[model samples]
Target: MSSRLARTSALTVAAVCGSALLVMTAVSASGNTAEEPRLHDIQGKTRISPFAGKQVTDVPGVVTAVRGFGKARGFWLQDPKPDDDPATSEGIFVFTGEKTPDVEAGDSIRISGEVAEFYPGGEEAGGQSVTQLTGAEWKAASKKKAKLPKAVGLGADRVPDAYAPEGKGDEGNIESLKLQPRKFALDLYESLEGMRAGLRNAPVTGPSTEFGELWVTADPGENPTPRGGTLYGAYDQHNGARMKVSSLLPREENHFPKADVGDELRGATTGPLDYDNFGGYTVRATAMGELKDNKLKRERTRKQSKDELSVATYNVENLSPESEPAKFERLSEALVKNLASPDIVALEEVQDDSGPQDDGTVAAGKTLKTLTDAIEKAGGPAYESRQIDPEDNADGGQPGGNIRVAFLYNPDRVDFTDRKGGDATTPVKVGDDGGKPKLSANPGRIEPQEEAWKESRKPLAGEFTFKGRQVFVVANHFSSKGGDQPMEGRFQPPVRESEKQRTAQAKLVNSFAKKVEAIDKDAAVIAAGDFNDFPFSPSLDAIREGGVLTSPMDELPADERYGYVFNGNSQVLDHAVTSPGVGPVKYDIVHINAEFHDQASDHDPSVVRMKP
Candidate 1:
């Protein structure tokens, strides 16, 4: 007897070939008399299995695929005859411990096991759970080749128009969401979990080189952006339409085909649907089609007129002297070629001279000098750098890195208004100097010791004269959204706890701008940098509450207003908010980075050209 038959005793003899006899049997070594259950009976029409905690005798299915490498070694089986209800899947996973299963594709078998719900990354992660059969016993009913069930089509017709249902239920809780298989894509994916699925001509939205995962959207999706990716709205519903595609075996040969944005995975992408920590419901591919490249190109913003002062903002992803000099050179090229070497550039994340080493050094002079030298070498204007170093490790970033916001001005075009008493802890205040608004301490920190900025980079306010017109510039690097729950987490309307600090920071910046406006109503105040929040977020609203400043992105068309891409959706975290009376500004979110695999920085620089 085979290992499959060693654990079971019940048998039903049947003839497959004329001479070969096949036995469909179920037995329990524990001597418990239990009836056999069908695959559909165990996998009811819900996100979780109906027979999750129960032990069953016989569950018949044909082996469709086998995965032997992972910690949870398992084989996927599909029932020949499926239930009429679309909400219930016909396939299930059978966990076979550390050893590889003897079962092969096309073999019909009957499995007896305890149904269990396994949460990857543990239950504390608040991630989705996978239902499988564990402590299993199985017997091959037929060694003769059995045809596998047809892969369920996941094209536009099969997938629902809406990514998720519109109701009060928890959207992130896949098991709790009211299953509307016909109305929402998320419901359909959840209902079809553990099933063999196929996507036809799915367009790749995000390509992961490290993990070989392809974020794709089936064709006929609504609100398709120009770059062929779906627009992720303020809500999490848009993510439902996008799915991650990977291989069951994490090997070079089995890896998902390389792709970029606007590329398409033509033909069928056949795989077994599974849920994991990285993405909610991912399809572990057994077979993939050819990758069709869309030839996406990087675009450079048009050069600004010499008379128009161009201001730009960029997050340099922690730059320091110890960092790779190649990065500085590449960044210089981006500034010169992509942004036209703006008259003034607000640089964020400039690390201390020693990078992340915790030796208590706070000055970033060497770091800025290296970047400026490279800028000049790259044929850009020689820029003069200005910044007040933060207290060692006081500003939260890479510990001891002392990352802070700074400014680079082209001396030929812009002049920094030098004043006394600018230091790491000094608070710059709006003052009346001979009846005109002036910064008491030029290039000073704005309320550095405030609770909101306790462990965050203080906003660096600088006074500059562009073409003899005085302008106040505030460069900020607000608290990041690090602790926010993932959009695909179990919590509905995923919590963004980082918003509180950012909102408080925005209000402080707004109040400072209001004071400058009070001194001079038409003060050309430009607050620009990585706010670490979206334009539609409450933080940006706080910045715009008093109408002291307005986001220049608001002037751009909705589809083209993004400066960053996260989870395959083009969005903006970098912004330039200017006083109401600034100019008919020409704003461009230069696409040098954020979309490419070889990007120098994670953010694309945003440029605003206006007569200041």
Candidate 2:
């Protein structure tokens, strides 16, 4: 499966195919007068072209690269004679429809076409538009081959520290803003859009994705995490160094490198800088780089001590009985070997037995059984499952999959406290048992009817006992970042509209945990799962406020805080936090799945070892 950014590329394909009208405008040689604008004149200084929507005759440039395959067939053209301005790019893309453009890289051409700002996935997509000359008709200006323009070097010295210009809130776009290439990275990229760009020995920040793409950083020192991936600490710190790299060569012929984090794209990787919806700015490589592996290895956390209770959170990405046996085996192996068989595991995306089939089967008994059976087979303890199944199709996920959070506890290590009467809509409550806090409904949903959890998974609160002491754990699969605008979108400091729901969810989780603490100040309450927002995000801030619970990420080293990688940035989406009652926990965010191309789930499981 591809990352969220890559998944949006499919929408871009449709956008490109629809723009293939190729309107051949017939005028006269008067259209080819000396007053014809150059490539930079059409590009202008801002993101949106000045000549947009106007039919211009004989725009001159040489073909730099050709994308012959796919529905959005096009060629990049570069003017050999460039202007002094750094804001206006000398190169631009010429969009040809279904047929490949009859032009070679060396040929100098003068094209007549309408300058159009083509949004890759439509204007409503909230992404930056690609300025192209569509319906283009051209003639060879010179038979003599011209040398390609020198690729502008995008090394550490050139890329800016700042990311983008501030978004014009009500206006919604930065298209009209003048380019400040030296001050902001986004502006720098916009200034050089559709132009020849190069990266030398670029450090791989994100692993090679399934969509034949990878993320690399030109600036080596831009918030470099200890694990080689770039750090995305906050919204304010959008790392300017990150750039997506895709090959211009056709899929069947091109051999994109398979690389992990810490690897290097050896030598100079030259390409025409293009903007797309998938990844904000991309380098469509004409000369691809060689992979230089740094031998980055997967990590394993130390096992929990005998007296300590080990709890782990893993999103077994939509696992069901219909899933491949290999997936079960891999997940089981990771649980047993990598995590050292934690006493309690909070699993997210536990699908129904029938998987994606919309047959109204909501129970995940078979799915849990299959996973537990695999764990036992993989030399782990025999685990028991606890979960409150949601109403049919009420939760949002794969149509009939009905994914929900479930707990897997080793019977030999811990005992599950089973309180009856837990159902889909019933809210879990903290009840006073003498002087201690007790769960009113063990394995119960936390405010399932709340508006914050409209189509999202309800938080599952389960009570367990380890060594005669009662322990409370709330497993959550919060609302995803589905509808949020891309970080590289037209709106600078792209708006995270999905954050509101997540923040609301976080407050609810915080309230529930606080109640457990209020009943007993020393209650060992833990909340963990896929929050689906960064640790520095407002959602996380809401959870950490008022000194109720402390995130284990605070104890972790700055560089080792991430459990998931997205768009090449190592960020924390899955997290675990403990009430003040739980003291001195050793936390580990295992690096197994997110870094490797072959993986059981996209998120890496995190383990917290503490004496409850």
Identify the leading candidate in terms of TM-score: 2
Angstrom error at residue 598, model 1: 2.4
**Lowest summed lDDT over 10 consecutive residues: which window, candidate 2?**
21-30
The CA lDDT of each predicted structure is 0.78, 0.85
Task: Compose the digit string of candidate 2's lDDT tens values, residues 1-612.
Answer: 113222222223342321122212211111222337999998899887766666788888989998776667889999999999999999998877667888988889999887766676566767887778877899999999989999999988899988888866574678778889999899999888888998999999988876778899998788888878898887787888899888876566437788888899999898899877676788988887889989888888888889999999999999999999999999999999999999999999999989999998999999999999999999999999999888999999999999999999999999987889899999888888888887778888999999999989999998889998888888999999987888888886677899999999999999998888888888898999999998888999998789888987788788888878888888899999999889888889999998776678999999998885
lDDT of 1 by residue, 1-612 (tens): 224323334322221111112222222233244557787777776655656656887788998888776345678888898878877777887877556888887889998987765555444455555667778899988869898788888776677766654334543445645567898776787778778887888888766545567677765365566777666556543656677787654465635566776788888888788766665677778878678888878778888887898899999998999878799999999999878889999999999999999998999999999999999999999999999989988999998799999999998998887888989888998898765679988888999888999889999999998887888899999999877766665555566889999999999999999998887787888999999988889999999997888987887877777767676676779999999757678788887777665668889899988885
Clashes of each: 2, 0
Q: State every prediction's TM-score relative to the real structure.
A: 0.86, 0.93
- Would you give me the overall lDDT of model 2? 0.85
Candidate 1 structure, TM-score to reference? 0.86
